[model samples]
Target: MAFWTYMLRCVDGHYYVGHTDDLDARIAGHQSGLIGGYTQKRRPVKLVWWQEFPSRAEALAAERQIKGWSRAKKQALIAGDWESISRLARSRSCR
Candidate 1:
């Protein structure tokens, strides 16, 4: 089965990252406040980015990696700005 790693923009302007095999159902749960966690409290979340992978391991790895990224890095991924993403990575390592 395929799995997806996704990012959501919450109502409060924060980002949520997760991996799921059921994309639509998972997003629906988040929307309906049934997820009962960060996005549940934030409410009215919007999908900002996603990537599909052949294996659950790949999707989960991507999710975990993205979760630790800075907001700017997330935005760069959402915007497909590889240069900005690379730059952000360098800046973080330099600090």
Candidate 2:
């Protein structure tokens, strides 16, 4: 069972983070507004980042950790700026 922690860029520019075992179907639900939740009000969502974990626990932990990141750090991650991401992570760890 492959679980994924995904980040979505919402219509209003906010980010949503969640974990699911079904990536494609989950994203579809978000896009179609079929899932009545926070994302539903946000309407269209774009998958800006994702990571695969071998276990559900790992995926969920990563999701929770990412959710705590500042918007700038999150955007850096989404932009694939590994240098900035590493710096942010290290800075956070020291705090």
On lDDT, the candidate that comes out on top is 1
Candidate 2 global TM-score = 0.91
Candidate 2, residues 19-87, lDDT tens digits: the string is 999999999999999988989999789999999999999999999999999998999989999999989
Enumerate clash totals for all models, in the order shown. 0, 0
Please report how far candidate 2 places residue 61 from its true position, in Å.
0.3
| Pairs of residues clashing in candidate 2 | none
- CA lDDT, every model vs. true structure: 0.96, 0.95
- Candidate 1 CA-lDDT value: 0.96
The ten-residue window of minimal lDDT in model 1 covers: 34-43
Q: Taking the tens digit of each residue's C-alpha lDDT, what string does model 1 give over 1-95?
A: 89999999999999999999999999999999999989989999999999999999999999999999999999999999999999999999999
Top TM-score hit: 1
- Residue 10's lDDT in candidate 1: 97
